[model samples]
Target: MNDSDRNPIEDTRFGEITVRQDGQNGLEVEGEGIPRVTLERDPESEVDRQIAIGTRDPDRLTMRIDGLEVGLKPAKGGLTRRSYRVDVEYRGADYRLVPDSVPGSRLTRDGVHIGDFSCDGDEIVLAEWKEGADIRPEDASIGYALASAFGTGGQPMWMLLIDAVGLATP
Candidate 1:
């Protein structure tokens, strides 16, 4: 069979974000309820426009995981499978977000770097914070970034992220 006949693989899905590895080694994703999420390298710069399953167009990815159906899924891909990652900086600290699994660690809405929130094996360190005090203004922005980062993978957590940051999930 020709290379054109090959297909890509969907790597991960946490909340609303889904990761797919194009057979060509390219990575893409689909954003479910996030209306304004995009690849922005820097907050001060324009977002990096590109292709994703539903990040830009939700209806575009329907046929999608709807109807709440489940069945035998394909085995996990090789270690080298391509995927996407996002980085967020809040309160002078940076966090890397990847499509893995987290054991439900609670990150404060005020941006506290308590420890690492692990997804499968990958994780990001949150900067430590003050003990019981109203968060600074920048902390709100941090909360939003963390939520957006985590929301790129699954469902309920995505809503959690939105609520944590006061950003609308729809």
Candidate 2:
């Protein structure tokens, strides 16, 4: 059958857990299962990537990312809820600006602003310059600066400070 015509049912292992994909969007597994586990996808969201991390057997941590859900196997030490960091990369730059970094500051190829933005293990927090401001794909200067700052590995003091100060003619 063609790719689109194929409603393939496949069983795969995520770490030590087993997962069965009913089709393209439905999933089931053998376990106690998580409570109220729902997957949400926001294409308009800043981050373009999503993933679910969980463990195998008795204790499972399942997360849905990019409209798909996956299971993560616990490390050797056993099941432990670990925080994963997701960085928002826009236009070859991070939204969070790091002070005193190389390339000075720049944007990504896709015109996405790289920011110190991260997901706090539960929710994704995107970098916001102004509350109501919308990010344009064409203008990547600010995004680039932010990405560069984040790559430099420091809290986005510069961007935060700049945003706090508002616009100035210098």
Candidate 3:
């Protein structure tokens, strides 16, 4: 079989975001909730002719932008596997958003980071926020992990749990 044929595509949705996995090394993303802005410039007008065009597009006006990246490799058992890392960035905004497995961690609506769960050894753990005081293995949630990873203010209860359970590598 050809190398391209060996790879498979996958798709999943997290919250309002729809993630598409392409051929073990490609990702195409499309969503309906992105905020956007439209600006119009008149070719006939000089510097004073530039005017702000308003767009009713649902994606306009959002603080975050979505994008994708991919990496592929050969795993054991002759299986071709692709690793995908999804990320977001906050433009002109303070605070970084990341994924967490610890319970009670706060999830920010204005930050950007990867939010996903991975298997570590025999348990599932959040991929990001490896060093925080809010990660808890037992009560892990997307929100709590964000709080711990980004330091959004929360008790260290989850952190202790994550430490006790031991983090797994993805």
RMSD of each: 19.0, 18.4, 18.6
- Model 3 alpha-carbon miss at residue 75, Å: 24
Q: Evaluate all candidate structures by whole-model CA lDDT and list the values in order.
A: 0.30, 0.27, 0.24
Model 1 ranges with Cα > 4 A deviation: 1-86, 90-92, 96-134, 152-170
Alpha carbon deviation, residue 23, candidate 2 (Å) = 20
Regions of candidate 2 where Cα sits further than 4 Å from its true position: 1-115, 124-126, 130-170
Please estimate how well model 3 matches the true structure, expressed as its whole-model Cα lDDT.
0.24
| Model 1 vs truth, CA RMSD | 19.0
Which 10 residues in a row give candidate 2 its minimum summed lDDT?
A: 77-86
- Among the numbered candidates, top lDDT falls to 1
Order of models, best TM-score first: 3, 1, 2
Error of model 2, residue 117, in angstroms: 1.2
lDDT of 2 by residue, 4-68 (tens): 32232121211111233322222322222221122222323333122222211213333332324
Model 1 Cα lDDT, one tens digit per residue, 1-170: 01222232221211233333332212233334322222222223322233221132211121112222111111122232113333344334544333333333233332434222323211122223335544443332222233323332333455556666786444
